[model samples]
Target: MGKVRGELRSHCPINFGIEIFGDRWTLLVLRDLLLQGKRRFGDFQASEEGISSNILAERLDRLTHYGLVTAERVAGDRRQIRYEPTEAGRALLPVLVEMAYWGARHDPRTAAPKSFALAYEADRAGLLRSVEAGTNPSEG
Candidate 1:
């Protein structure tokens, strides 16, 4: 496991993972980057969850601090910033995928598309690769 940004609660891996990204907003930010191809601050704000600017800023900072994401100046535009997932961030794809799967199976109101669930079951590895490549697997 990668190093967490702050002091750990315990040696338990689950606890550590939760400490890193236990908040509801943190995973949403990761979802935007991993699944929605959202790279800008505004894009995240535009998400359906209606996240506040303060919370978005806090999550992005924490993700960056934990080495899950990187924020860089967009080329030719100093004022514009692009957020990209680091390798460590990309590594969370499987976790996210499994969570989606579980939610689809257990939650009747889950928005996970049937096509995505089927495609994921058919080619889990390929789907992960597509996601890591910044493409939506269900779209293809």
Candidate 2:
């Protein structure tokens, strides 16, 4: 069961955010869902990070419980479920983008581009708008 806001150790917003994504795998699962557009269990397993099956299942369940993702059966396939981000999940785009910027800035070998940080810095709102409209800064 998810820890409700009232049950949290503190009412701090940052603490709430950390409670959702403090683990290593949760945010990566979200990155795949929101940024990489991966939906299947196999798809997430195939990620470069190579998360284990048990951990992925747990994270997906947690995300569903927390209203961050929705799992629906694939058309004509009851066994194959597709996962998608909910409004709450999509709202994490800024966090993802900021992390990308921070990584690109600090890491010499980061795959993230420096120009995107410049782009985001110049028009933070516009970039987020574009991403929400299915045009991501991560795309070529």
Index of the highest-TM-score prediction: 1
lDDT of 1 at 133: 70
Minimal lDDT window, size 10, model 2: 1-10
Point out where model 1 deviates above 4 Å.
Answer: 1-5
lDDT of 2 by residue, 66-122 (tens): 899999999998999999999999999889878878888889898877667777888
* TM-score against native, each model: 0.88, 0.87
The digit string of per-residue lDDT tens for model 1 on 34-135 reads: 878899999999999999988898889889988999999998999988999999998898899788778887898878888788878899888888777767
Local error of candidate 2 at residue 65 (angstroms): 0.4
lDDT (C-alpha, whole model) for all candidates: 0.86, 0.84
Clashes of 2: 0
- Over all chains combined, what TM-score does candidate 1 have? 0.88
lDDT of 1: 0.86
Task: Identify the leading candidate in terms of lDDT.
Answer: 1
Q: What is the lDDT of residue 114 in candidate 1?
A: 82
- After superposition of all CA atoms, the RMSD between model 2 and the true structure is 2.7
